[model samples]
Target: MRKDWQNLAPAHGLNALVENGTIENLEVKDHVANILETNGVDLNDVEGVIWSHWHFDHTGDPSTFPSSTKLIVGPGFSEVFTPGYPADKNGHCLESDFAGRELQEIDFSGSDVTIGRFKAFDYFRDGSFYILDAPGHTIGHINALARTNASPNPGFIHLGGDSVHHAAEIRPSEYLPLPESIEPSPVPKLHSNACPGHIFAPVLKDGSKTEHILEWQDPWAEFVEPKFGLIYNEKDLRETVRKDEELDANRDIFTFIAHDWSLKGVVDEFPKSLNGWKNKGWKETTRWLYLRDFQAAVV
Candidate 1:
């Protein structure tokens, strides 16, 4: 049987992705650990751990799993973490750290790994679920896609890993509150190239003898971060919406930024049985509710 699914990394650790500058929240880690414990699945038994990227939020609990488990990383997992473009102190881990664990390095030959012209990660052999590689939010950033059998058309549950932030950032009609300190002017043309977000970037022109480097707009810029609202400045959520619309056109692609408040119900409703969860009941301290009614909605 297929390994059961769990909210490995659920709950908004980062405060409000919209107004708060917190990129990731520690609380999310607590939630992830709690979810695992609630399901009665020992962290030591986790056979594999897939890290979409080296972002702190995603890699918060790298040490939690057993050293014997396999760890899967994206194309430049090692490069991005150590002596890479923009080195992050908390974002990556060295090979030596794993010791005896297996490491699966997926280097899509520099091509996007998703289905349909982009980086897509499929689970099992069914293609019902997938992970989309969408950098720019980070060097190796990716998004999760879940196609529920409930609908004839694709019913995608996009777990956006900072690729596209809150829905307000994508909603064209939403009025965003922009800080006056931050200008409304276009991001410098050269800035985008200097930054690593562009999937295609920094072109070299002229002859090899005297190479002249020129930068061009990335066609996939929309997928990175689009101009839809004030908060969407970092990512082109518009592109994400467009791509999501194209592939899962029925409009069932549910977009959930890591920190969205609405996720409380979704995470709570996540099948405990699938993850081997044994604990139940609401908590008065966190005001957390494990409503049977909500759990019944999973099917």
Candidate 2:
């Protein structure tokens, strides 16, 4: 997977490629279809492909999937993104992608189910999986919360699709404050095996005191500022992120954003079950990994 991702990395670099969208890029060798095939899953077995939004990155080459596979999307999707590129010249998706597939749009207004201030739909109608109305990044942006385990103690995994660009945007909250020390050292060259939390005080947001790192402060300004800015609605995005933070605070819930690069080699890849993440201590080990990017500020 890493090799495939490396192949997709723009030769001109991400920023440059973004600036010049017309540049011919390398072919994406690692499509979901290929991955499923590698895992012994047949293309015809895929029931549906749930799109978080209409973004080019999230919406892969849907043409690769069998026509029997349904294409599911959030509310307001068909009104804007349907008929795709050639039919709607300004559209970001291609007509071939939805050619013979059933395009289903989710409507949350009819469902009274609420999960942490966001309207939710029970996909299975059994409370095991939920599709959350998490708009802000785009017109029909959505998220998923899956019940990983069920018993006296339940564990959930929140698939926060583009809710925030990075984990720091919603972390270091009052519930999960930065620890006094971070193990596996975010910056191994600067610290031994464990990095002291106070070393990061210099990079804290303005008006955030050194003590705030150890104990989260009200008005919560300890997170790193997001670098990218293509947010459709900043206000609504902030609210969505705030609600995500509430879920992240819970130890039983493992929440991850789509673009958290820090989790690359840390977690188990596809074909391997992530159900044992809690027992493996993945959350604790990966919590402060993003701080490595702030090493220069502290130095």
Candidate 3:
């Protein structure tokens, strides 16, 4: 989120989790600074802090904010957000102080809970600008969808939270570098001459199925390489199942993730905002140009 050196943690021993070249250490404050510069959105004005799950990068600088800020974390934020986590599994940065501010943990025990303005959040009604149910990344993993309502299609611009990392990961392209904790194997490109459509599901078809879209095993498929363990084998599967069931129940809601880098390109190509925020949603608009536009702007 914050693109500053100070925000990056010192590499001391994060080699266990990240691939080569990832920043190892950064401070809570430094990331806050980057958030301020890039998005121009005032952190002080952030009405709520919805941490999809408690990962270091996602929870970068939690303490910098005032305690009054309501923190929305998974039900098990306490258990997984601790020092023994795989990334911090070495017991190095396990100090509880890493969580800058006290958290208001929101547990979703397969039930609808009122968070903010929506009636039945997580899968009850049409989610507002900042919430969704996307578990699986963590036992308590979830997704948050935000929109300003100014766009012609507010339903189209959903913030997926961390359920997905980037757009390429979801698009018909090759798989991007996945986090080892989630997928342990390298993503294969199938075959050299294969079209991107080749990555879609249901490898075979017949008159039994019928039509241009024949027998799809998985419609929203991504070539996952679960690093922590197989999705069905892990102990966290129960929670994952509960969350997925809820998401499927309310599948009509349009949501997007919070940290997708490619989303800005889509945002830039088509920027819209709900009526609530002034100057459209560009309160912090500087860092959002398309890749070339951003490069040229800096040049």
Q: What is the TM-score of each candidate against the true structure?
A: 0.50, 0.83, 0.48
Segments of candidate 3 deviating more than 4 angstroms: 1-30, 37-42, 82-100, 113-130, 150-156, 166-264, 269-299
Q: lDDT of all predictions, in order shown? A: 0.42, 0.74, 0.39
Ranking by TM-score: 2, 1, 3
C-alpha lDDT of candidate 2 relative to the true structure: 0.74
Error at 179, model 1, angstroms: 27
Ranking by lDDT: 2, 1, 3
Off by more than 4 A, model 2: 1-27, 207-229
The candidate scoring highest on lDDT is 2
Better of 2 and 3 by TM-score: 2
TM-score of 2: 0.83
Better of 1 and 2 by TM-score: 2
Model 3 TM-score?
A: 0.48
For candidate 3, which ten residues in a row score worst on lDDT? Answer: 177-186
RMSD values for the candidates in order, in angstroms, are 17.0, 6.4, 11.9
Candidate 3 lDDT, 1-299, residue by residue in tens: 33332323332233433445555453345555355546566666765667666445565544455655556666555564454323474332234334455555554455565433222254324444435444556545656544445345433234445554433223221111112121111122322221232222232122111112211122213443332222312434333333422332232333344554433533443223433333443312211111221222222
Backbone clash count for every predicted candidate, in the order shown: 14, 0, 35
Error of 1 at 267 (Å): 6.4
